[model samples]
Target: MAEPFPLAPSLWATTAPPGPETPPLTESGQADVVIVGGGFCGLSTALHLAERGIRPVVLEAREVGFGGSGRNGGQVIPGLKYDPADLVAKFGPERGERLARFAGSTADTVFDLIARHAMDVPHRRAGWIQGAHTEAGLAEVARRAEQWAGLGAPTRVLDRSETARLLGTERYLGGWLDGRGGAIQPLSYARGLARAALKAGAAIHGQTPVTGLSRSGSTWTVTTAQGARLSTERVVLCTNGYTGGLWPGLAQTVIAANSFQVATKPLSDNLRRSILPEGQVSSDTRKLLLYFRLDHTGRLLMGGRGPFREPRTPRDWAHLERIVGKLFPQLDGTAFDHRWCGRVAITQDYLPHLHEPAPGLLIDIGCQGRGVGLQSTMGRAIAQYIATGDADSLPLPLTPIAPLPMHAFHRLYVSAIIAWYRLSDGGIR
Candidate 1:
């Protein structure tokens, strides 16, 4: 067996053993759709398809949510990773409005799923605050809030005092708040989605790695390492970051970047109250952003960009500890109980893609860092497209597959870009 990815620790390993281990495709099987990956996108698509009387078989390399879906910042934020205006500029006004509405509703879709499935993920609707690290950043947030409000979304601009009151910290200049945003225990949510999909009559096979795939006369035959195969009418690829060469062209379109997070030991009531008075998730408006929130137990969870690839040393924990202390000086001595990192799929345009490279094949990946909410919305759209073959219903624009230029040089470019952005954020531009 291949070694597991380093970023994903076994801290939140699935408590409920995966739905019995699925034997490799020794004998050929058939299904309406054969989905690859058991994360949010795959699970959500399977659940929706099952509800529509289409039972899909999901193949997983490891357990469900074993990838980035299981270990993320857990911030259920609204909107796509890119600016709506940029989307409008790329597409047009009418299509842009439609996409904007869809992006804004991503968070609502996540909450709805949690409620409908009764997923015990400790979800909350306390909203999210986009903290501004500088005055210009605060103004930019205000302008964004105004624009979103103009589009009839629930957004509010906050002043410095208001920001401090809401976040319980004076580190920020000001920011915007959207009531639709919230947080979740992501691993639990992903597992809950898997359970819900299974209850809806979808077959999820864990530890069944898809080694290869071939087109077979209007259908697809997906093969596992054990020489087992499954023929399905359609295929959906939802493997986000751990998509290690599954599809030839798929990996070229997105850059895999590492993101790290550290969780401090549960805080005392007084410290918790002094840190996050409103229990809302918060992220600063920086290129290499800092996102933090207080979990149910009042533990401060902070996450930000890690090294270009993955960190390979125990000293990475010390780096994260220093960052946490720098951000919240009051928590300098707090012991960190958990530290982990995960990969995020970033597209060239900073927007997600829902592409159909061939008939009966759908791909939904490149969520950037906004997969928590975006996955649910995109998953539903994918299910709709799979059922009706109407690509227009997708939350994002469906365009030709275009690989990023100089794909192999992404690590060097990303490193320079991140460093430049960090300097710009510090007023060095």
Candidate 2:
């Protein structure tokens, strides 16, 4: 067996109090719902259900937000990983408009929840800039901005000078600024969601891995590795990237890719003021994108493509450091305060999936790289679906579940494609 990756200590570790760690299910118990995975989706769903007087039991293999929910770039930018145009092409214009609205409104939902729950996750609606690193990329960014504006979003296209003024880098030609987008401390947000769920009367069990799941009559029996079992009327699988092997078919449809990030020591006031004067999170528009933002402590957190396959040691944090230096040469030689990596699930079409694998079974996975904002929206949708059996409440279209063709070859295929993109970025045609 591969050794488990070391859990990097996060700033949130010091901020939020530890959540309650319920002992693993020991004997057969019963509940209204059994939720798998304690990340944002599971926790948010539990909270919603609890509010509606439905008690839910959440089982998490690791601590809450132990997956991408806690370790993401924290860029709560709007929209899905795939383009809105593509979604419109796939689904009709009306459904596509609704999906777009859901994606765009996701940021509001996140910030609203933080406010209503008094969750101190250092959230800032500082807007976000989608930088364009090349001439073609710049044109595309302009086109996208126009499309968004036409769709009633408040987006503006910025020239090279404006881009440089906002980003403190000459690396990009131009970009788009979407005021609706923002950033947050991801782990803190996840923990806040857990606290909210707990306060709402939901039970969350950490360090409890579900070993076996079997259908018994109208109820589903969930057995934990530690000799505990729960018989529930409904089962929700919100495992996402850290799904482990619970549902093999769902796992096959999504590839777990590792994304790494490094944070520098707090920047000097002068440098911090100049880089992001407006306090907006920024990301470049490359196939393998580079995302960065100033944390609550004024440190520069930079992240990009990395660890293409499984989560393993010997991470290339140095590569991230070099990239950061290239983007801000003045920050060269600055000591990094932390380096970490996490896995994100990417689907074939680069979209999230909500599937009904069996009766009373609802599996939601594949957020690609945009789970932070979308997860909450998905949680609300799932809760409504479970409560009223209405698929129309979902944010994204619920298409038929089609597993990836030739699943075993994903690693090789993804690695090669990533290498090609890297080489292209390096000016190799």
Candidate 3:
């Protein structure tokens, strides 16, 4: 078995609060709702379901926060990749606007969950800044700011000088800030959600991999690796990037791209003040983007595209370390405390998808690096739909699960695209 956690320590694992007990499932079980994967979405789904008096049984192949939920960049950014107007054009004004609005409030869903549960997760809602790497990028941020402001968001566009002052670097030409976005201790948040769900009467079993999903009459039979079975009327698959063949063709619906990250040792107060002084998280608008933030103790974390699979060595993070020095020359000699990687699910549509391929079987995929906030809200919506049996109550419209065409060669094509994007984005800082 792959170790419960990555061998190389992450900054989160070093500093996060102790997680709750999640014993493995060793016996057969029964449930009203069965949730596979114990990441943000699954835990949040269980929490919401328990709040509605529906006890859900969550089975995790490893531990909670074992996936992207624990390994993400920790930026709680809101909205999908597309702009609101574009969304309206794609899904039409009605369902499109609903999705846009829903996407816009994802950050609120996250912070609210932390506040509502009084979770012991370290977090700050200072804001999120989207730095523009070029004139075209600047135009995109301006459009984003204009549209979000029209929606009553506390959004603003910053010119080059202002961007430099706020971001501690003149690398970008301009940018926009979204006051609704923020940062959090992601692994801690995941563990907190698991705790909250357990307190609400939900059952969670870690190290219990669901090997297969089969139908037996009106019930769905969930078989785990340990030879235990869970029988339930409804089964929800929240496995995103780590999705396997539990359901044929499901994993092929999205590409699991590896995101590499590095965290520097806590900076001096002067260095910290010069960088993100107000505690805002920032990600630039580049074809191959870079996202960064400061942890509560002032450690700078940088994340972006990396190898298509799990990084094999320290050299896998050389690009990020060099880019960090370029972005903040003052930290040129700063020692890095951690280096790790995780998979981000990229859907063909660049939108979160809800799939109901069969009755009592529902699937959600395609986080696209915004899973921290998007998945939280999606979990609530999914829980609401399951509890009320009202499909219209869902914030995202359900779509059929169709595998991506030419999926097998995704890694080759994606790596080529990343290389091209890197060249276009000025070749890694």
Q: Which candidate is the best by lDDT?
A: 3
Q: Could you tell me the lDDT of residue 277 within candidate 3?
A: 80
Candidate 3: tens digits of C-alpha lDDT, residues 1-429: 675334576778888988899999999979999999999999999999999999899999989998899999999999999999999999898988888899999999999999999999999999999999888988999999999888888999999998999999889999999999999999999999999999999999999999988997889999999999999999999999999998889999999999999999889999999998888999999888999999998899999998896677788889999999999888989999899888899998898889998999989998999999999999999999999999987877788889988999999999999888877785555
Which pairs in model 3 have colliding backbones? Answer: none
Per-residue accuracy of model 1 over 38-135 as CA lDDT, tens digit each: 88889899999999999899998878887889888889998876567866887799888888888888899999999998877777888989999887
How many backbone clashes does every candidate have? 1, 2, 0
- Candidate 3 lDDT for residue 161: 93
Model 2 regions more than 4 Å off: 1-5, 11-17, 20-23, 309-315, 426-429
Q: What lDDT does each candidate get?
A: 0.81, 0.83, 0.92
Shift of residue 205 alpha carbon in model 3, Å: 0.4
Candidate 2 residue lDDT tens string, 163-262:
9999988888889999988988888899889889889999888888998889978888898988889998899999888877777577888898888888
Name every residue pair that clashes in candidate 1: 25-228
Best of the candidates, TM-score: 3
Residue 329: error of model 1 in Å? 1.8
- Candidate 3: residue 316 Cα off by (Å): 0.3
